[model samples]
Target: MKNIILSATLLAMSAGAALADAHSVVRMGTEGAYPPYNFINDDGEVDGFERVLGDELCARAELTCEWVLNDWDSIIPNLTSGNYDTIIAGMSITDERDEVIDFTQNYIPPASSLFVALSEDADLEGGVIAAQTNTIQAGYIAETGATLLEFATPDETVAAVRNGEADAVFADGDFLLPIANEDADLMVVGDPVQLGGGVGMGLRETDTELREAFNAAIQSMKDDGTLNALIIEWFGEEAATF
Candidate 1:
């Protein structure tokens, strides 16, 4: 009789441990200040298009995900170090980036672009455009006989241009649109620069299973009305397509 009681207690403990391990949280990291993608709202909630998208992906994969906010440049390193399992920031899939991190299939298609002030002093008269460091947008604008100054992130570039520290800023069109719309002092102009690849959800090279699950979940959302409805609600019309 004692043996039977001991066995039952062991089984209960094992089951409890298994339940805890199964629900182990998956961490998501992002640049919390990048507007329209991931940003800290006045209420201190990390909310944006990417936030909603990441939550849906975690739900579809049957995982619990915790959102972590960090600066842009350090995001990938943190992921590689296992601080997080994934990144849902507005990260593009370029071969240069793929050399470092493994990306699930392109999740969002961004139109690369340049935006300058409406000031008569605005010199998009076909010169150099500045963009974030190592971004495809910088490379694209560099081809236009415009010298490209690579800043650390969009916020820096925007600040530079707004304060006359730089002539124009180049980046993802949709992201720039929101900022430009909010600040009358700035305006987005000129044709968008196109890059071939699509933006992707990032994961470490050892996380193929997680990547596959995320891709599958994204496809499922796309097939149903969930993805479309969310896109419209956030963008007020349609999500940008590549």
Candidate 2:
């Protein structure tokens, strides 16, 4: 989904100079809230599938890297402003977003978006649906007859449904399936919505060199089957891969 304000900034930066170098200690940005993708562990360190994948990527590309946490809403803005060198967040590659920032070839393939509710019969078509602000799911809901409620974080979107603030929460199936399986009160309510091209790393349009480096790294993982293994490890065997 696109935000007009950020789109303006992105367009402004698209023609600017590249901010990364081969020897630079690349700063990797993430939300540190969405689990299995990226999150802060008990040790207060950035930990998750992205963490491991990012580390390997850095090694393969022979670049030093450090993690930077940013709120999801401002992740792109911060990157454009040079707060980080790249976004290793589980961001989907979409035409609307490609207008703002460049994306590497997808590390995670296009996957289903599932609707989760407290009851099996919950109204999914016309009911109020919760989704994280600025996400594809939120954009999809806005086009439907259903009322869309936006939250700042993925957890908050799920909380909205649990607390009856919304009839259902829609998000990546990988993110919601674990929650649904662990909670007896929650269940998937409808067929999965296929959204976005796939999940990939976001980089400034000017950072072509850096993007190419990471792209090569990702391709290596894919060829060796490490990428698929990581997908299965974090999201189960059913999760889509490159």
Candidate 3:
């Protein structure tokens, strides 16, 4: 998901970062609720594009890593608190977030942010719009003419639209397209809005060595065409690549 500009609470969260041992198991944190990115499969294991990509990165970096489930809203705070070593969730790189933590080069390129509603004619500019809290979409809506409704999770934003609590939901197109396709009641509305820089792995600012290791691994994948291949495998052939 795209990032939000830091609030006072977010600034506070970045004040302290837990020190990590270089040779220990690196814990990779993620919100396992987003599909094609990160999610818990039927087998109860973390599975998705990021799951596969993260493993490859660890191998290339020669780091021992383990996955940890985290809620999106607190993901950054948890990382600073030393709950995990890195955040490999679909977190977009943004200037405000960069003030709080470090990021590797983008894995996914910049993508569109779209709105989904029960009707194609939904008033995207002036209607009640739902978005996951602390995201760029939510931040955008608050600054627009639309009435913004914040939800704790992506699924809740979709639910608000379905139950008449919201006129539409604004979020990453990669995340909303499959929902619109499977649910006949929903449809994409309004012109796509591009926000944030791109999706990248987040690390505490102090983890420079870890950040550089992942950066090298990501660059290696890009150099050999494997990264582009994985992007297509999960997000389809049209997905943007390096």
Full candidate order by lDDT, most accurate first? 2, 3, 1
Task: Give the Å shift of residue 214 in candidate 2.
Answer: 0.4
Report the C-alpha displacement of residue 178, candidate 3, in angstroms.
0.9
Give the total clashing residue pairs for model 1. Answer: 3
RMSD from true fold, candidate 1: 9.3
lDDT of 2 by residue, 58-143 (tens): 77766778999999999999999999988988898899999989999999999999999999888888999999998999999999
lDDT of each model, Cα atoms only? 0.73, 0.87, 0.87
* Candidate 1 lDDT over residue span 1-242, tens digit each: 55554453444344334434544887888888777878888999899988998887776666678998767778888889988878888888888778889997766755556566656456664654668876677777666766777787788888888777778887877678778888888887766677747778888898766676676666666555576677667665746642
Using TM-score, rank the candidates from best to worst.
2, 3, 1
Q: On lDDT, who's better, 1 or 2?
A: 2
* Candidate 3 segments whose C-alpha is farther than 4 A from its true place: 1-21
* Candidate 2 steric clashes: 0
TM accuracy, model 3? 0.90
